[model samples]
Target: MTKAFIIPLLLWANSTYTQTSLNLKPGDTLTYSPRSDKPAWISIQSNEANMVVALFMDGKKVKEQDDSRGIKSVERLYYIPEKGRKYELKIWAKSYIERSKPVKISINESKNVDILKGQFSPDQLVEDLHTFRAIREQVNSGLYVYRSKKQIDSIYQQAETETRNSKTIFDFYKVIARLTGFEGSCHNYTDLPNHASYYLTQKSEYLPVTLKNIDGRLLQDSKGVAMPLGAEILSINGVPAKEMISRLAQYYFSDGFSMPYRETIGFDRGMLDKFYIEFGTHKNYVISYRWNGKVDEVSLPGISLENFKKLQESRHSLSFDKKLMSEKYSLTKEGEGIYRLSLRGFDFAVGQEDPAYKKFSVFLDQMIDTLEKEKIENLIVDLRGNTGGTGAVYEKVFTYLTQRPFRDSHYAYTKFNEVPMGEKLVITPLFLSNGVQDKNGLNAYLKQLYPKAVQGKYYWADDKNPSILPNEKTFKGQLYLLVDQRVASAASHLASLIKSYTNAVVIGKETVGGYYEHNGHLPLVYELPNTGIQTGFSIVHVIQDARNLPDQKKGQGIVPHIEVHQTDQEFLEQTDVYLKKVFEYMKK
Candidate 1:
């Protein structure tokens, strides 16, 4: 029952945001006892002010903010089910903008008593089957037509395969996870049997000479050219890339937002070791890809997974700018007190109880106070990296900043028609339940509409039908927000809300969250490893951010009010040129 030691570490979506070490901006750090038992609660001290932290068991609630605690004191409480491998701890933070981090948390379940206490039986299996079936129906009914059929067939096969394989549901679920790997949907995962931990790393066996879509029709004889972020499908030793693709897809499925098939097609091999490429189950050839988008084909023996990873890391160092990260992260005190704060994203390693969030919170509060204090003529509020965080925290921020009756503040939205609750699809009145002085708040009603939705629980980056704004007494001074394509989901909601303000100006790129509206999801199937099947799709289209009436076309995402974007060259320069221009305007 015992083996080696493991620790819970988080792999933050660091690529989403820029890392800036500045005065007005903040950083992060953490505090936790090393020898804690399972279900251990870790204390976090974040640098950002006015943030709220909460924990979840695979997206279900564990903890949240309280009056006694200032900000993010109780960061996350992990349930360490005794899996032999490891599961990355998923922790989310809601600040001026929302962010998330995946950390490694060790589950100590080797104790004989612990094992005795944790073991599930045939009765437990029945319960799991019942739970999974009910959830599967919910997920299946709401899919976007085509995705629905696939989900049904996938689940049916996984269940059947489990019985035939004489495998536990746990082992079966792992196989189901393999098929739906390209989805890039987060929190959509399966567990291993007997709480045996599965390693997230590519530490297991692997191939080299990664490749993307090859028309076995054309490249059957030749090894495919390499590009950035490409996948290794086959080995020089004639192993199929199916397993490899499945594993790689599993990693991205945590993404959830993008279309799976298209992503697979556009993949590039950024860095891969010199291994042979066995394209399409047959002919083998050696391959090399240069930094300048050039391909080199050769006849090589083989490469190890470790060598592939090292080569990829080396290539990443070459492709990703080093100096820019250093320069961009450097902060300069813009002015007295009112320092310009512009960083990319929220970093948990920066710590749970980070000062950056606190400083930003204080900065926001003081900004309002300063407007009243110095009788300042104008104010420029830039919200670029703000993803939606603890919805309650935003409630406080919005209440203080935009005070008035939310009678006129109604957000428009459309619901997942499958639920067929009613024709009236609206979100503004719902989220802004108790805005008016005379009313108690529509909070109770919204909760009833979607039972799973809770106040403190984190919503997706793009929650539909979010909180309503008070159109009355909005900031008259120039409130300019600079967005990029990165402005997504919750960020999109906030941007749209700000634009709805009487005098606010939204400047920057379009948002990445879907244009219509969709919610964060939980996978329905338990999965069986080795089988090419899975059940996945949204349970409900629960719209959080939508406009009046509806926009039926669901492919593209939302657009910005004052549209702006950097050229491909400008983007490569790693300059927020639009941010730069916005600053130029603020100077005036």
Candidate 2:
């Protein structure tokens, strides 16, 4: 799914559309234009099941939806319109259709709507839950990656039982999120509906303190009125710190059996958001903590979202500025023969011709040129907070690091060639514009790309798993890889490649991404019927080209050869403990 699909789903609400009754032939097209600049929900229902709807803004194709599954008669689309911009909705029958039918089209202009307080009956919630389950079972290739079928069924039963008591959309969201997280794929997640998220931002009751988890202990990273920095939190609002962490951890998604990822998310700024969801709004907090050598209690008032942001900026020790966050890669000369390349992220464009990809390619080329000219003997690749991006970008980076030929993955597979639940799936506009408009088009494209792929079975993506030679100017110096819990997806893939094929010394905490295999590649997103909640999961199950090291275990993330974590003093002083370890290792 695209950013437009995900962001608008959380920021907009549904409304009644102007009903229009129409009778058209198979080849005829019906165009509906909105009168205002507000977001609109367009719904088209046909007596037959071959209606294709396309959205055009400023004469450019924005999105296209064609639901010919004959399952649901209505096809819905949501789009936010710009002022003075011309938008048109084009509806037509598929070219293969021989006959035409009566179609009912409606456009609902979205207004200021509050879905936070919206309540659903037991039946409505259950229906949505069933729909969610059906979609996952049919489309998610990694549904049983970590858990057995029996275990998944039992979890679903538990979710259904909990759903019966859910009144608000937020309540159901928790049940769904917990279930999604339990699936153990980092890519799987169910986001709260837009209005509910909006509701959170408007409320003034939120935990003000930022936290850091060092070796399972939650410590205050920010200075509060009564608690000092590095104070160990024993409890909050009478709930034991251990119990609270464990309970809130379930709401976060991580790769199979990886605890560090959940721990990282639990103690970061996400703590405030997850706390509000799990424990509800709080005006004040009774916090018990250990500062220095004594344990004490503190009563602190909750801060608003605005105030929390300000507090994080002023007091949080690990808060990053906008420039730091935006940086993709940086290289610094550490010593006479040592250089540290910090790859913050891998979210560059995949195409070689694209400006982003070209820039990244040039940066790597220059780094290699410098290494050759300066006679740099040691290179440290620091991937501390990288959270993954384009697989091709990582592959490109690996080419410059390794002298031997490498394949991106050992194997990659998906459940289906054609998209399952096409009627309910929210596809990106890029897919549609590239001729994948409906089930048949998707099937044809998949078959063309993966000629050996079969329907209703695991189709190995061999075409995408081709081996390639190393770059001419591959780095030949001694290498060291620095990774932490925040390293995931493509970033972790790079770590896995380096650890597997090269003699690079691996250090720092275990990565959040799987070491051997993970559910990745194409993501399929669906919106729940009742709550309008969007749930997404990656369809491709990727088995990476990794060596079976004793430390790298199954159903776990990339465990470094030398596992190191931040100490209390280092955390408080905002020191790079991993780099300190690297320098310590160099002495030997």
Candidate 3:
């Protein structure tokens, strides 16, 4: 791939109009000004094999385009240009760039401009309404997290009522996203469908600053000089910031709410941008914020989309706490007889070229060897930021920690034995077919259940067999598990297993993807036929015993034995607040 570079040029100069062009490579940027007051059309044609283009208007990303149908992606934005206002067009190859592609970009006064106007036809709006209803039906039937069908139906109906009154495609996107959130299932989300994605990209605008819900307050996270660091947000464009986030949160989780999950997904740049577009695309926002216990208001101009994206990247790079969290999966010596092992994720494709998976295997082997060689006493398994993948990814780690038997999950159940697959509804299969062959009796039982698999009926594993495999080098030490809300899916299952089968004290926030009712194994994505809004749901429902709490309620998060919360001071200082608590406990 070629290195990044930017070449800027002035296109034309006249009393009525002025234009600029930029030659962009991977990670490169270019800014241009619209010269005329009339409606302007910006067009892009790139020669790169797979290029993704991002369009920013008045400092906010309005649209993005990607390669399509054997053609390098071509996209055009049409909008009434504000004279002397600047717009940005940035391009890069999605994977890698062998060489800089020749891109032809131009801004011209449009002759026929009504097509750029933002309004869907009555027929198109009707089609989108039907699509939204279908999406609601699919969620009501397939999602395994809900306790009852009535609960799911109620949430879908709310979305249905909103969809019926929706006029534009952007309005439909907002409503569908809200319903997806109501499902309260992580990994299930909605986005602009392919047919309508291009039309809205050129017109949408978003709130410039990125935010995080910290201490129940919306705080601006961008390190830009214009905004105060960790400033408490009060309102945006006259609407209360909390009210705005509450509305946006509807598109994420309905129940089983995780703060980390909500802030990360709900308050992201794209969703915030879509929210503003769905409401109204405004150039400048009047924002109210609080700093040092005093309230203040400012008219903040929206920053470029690329600028906001770059800010997030910079924050991760600069944060010391995040640096300590990264190693993918590694074992490190903190002090004599004490070691900290960080396992970032468990999502592995088993036999794929997964570095995290390969490293986890190697790390476990080395950890055992080290434990055998040294008189290690405390081993801290860090699962703080793990969002989960495959549950069996850490089977070897389990072997070194246990001497007796270990049950991964109590049992798994599904609403349907045979569920239809694909958008085309091809390859319907029984739920038992999704089971992995780790246990002997359970594997055999699953195969037998395959023949008796029935549709639209709940099915479950009959066998509650425990896996018994102790590694030769079993470490007899005090095991400590470090976890937080980010620990989810299979990672959450592993947390439950550690508490259940091994002698370990879990320390941190209550886990979001809990033992009794978190969904996994195999998930399916479905696209609404008419509007093309995509949503996904998990088929298998797994129940595992909470390690320390024997009587934990269904869908309840695994409460930590020693709860720890990050103070704002600790966060800014990049302190290991959770680990510090563990250190103090060991000394005691």
Top-scoring candidate (TM-score)? 2
lDDT of 1 by residue, 1-588 (tens): 112222343333431111122212222322212332444333333332223334333435455542111121223223354434333332222221111222222222211121112223445444444444544443432333225567656765665455345334334444444433323232243333222111112233343444443321001111232423432223334334443443333323322343332223222331121121112221334433332345443454444445655544443222432432332112333443333334333331132245655665555565555555655444444445444343333333444345443221132211321232111111121122223111122233333444442342322232433445542333445555556544443445455445543355556654544444444322122221122122334333334333442422443344445666444344334465655665666667
Q: Model 1: runs farther than 4 Å from truth?
A: 1-134, 138-361, 369-387, 396-474, 477-489, 499-512, 520-541, 549-556, 561-573, 577-588
lDDT for 211 (candidate 2): 64
Question: Which residue pairs show backbone clashes in model 2?
Answer: 10-194, 17-107, 17-108
Give all candidates' CA lDDT scores.
0.35, 0.74, 0.58
Would you give me the overall lDDT of model 2?
A: 0.74
Clashes of each: 91, 3, 10
Best by lDDT: 2
- Residues 64-140, candidate 3, lDDT per residue (tens digit)? 76522112233445556565666665655332111223444333334332222335655665565565555445433
lDDT of 2 by residue, 314-347 (tens): 6555553243355779889988799988888887
- Model 2 ranges with Cα > 4 A deviation: 1-115, 195-203, 313-315, 320-326, 429-441, 454-461
Better of 1 and 2 by lDDT: 2
TM-score of 3: 0.70
Name the weakest run of 10 consecutive residues (lDDT summed) in model 3.
423-432
Candidate 3: residue 117 lDDT (0-100) = 32
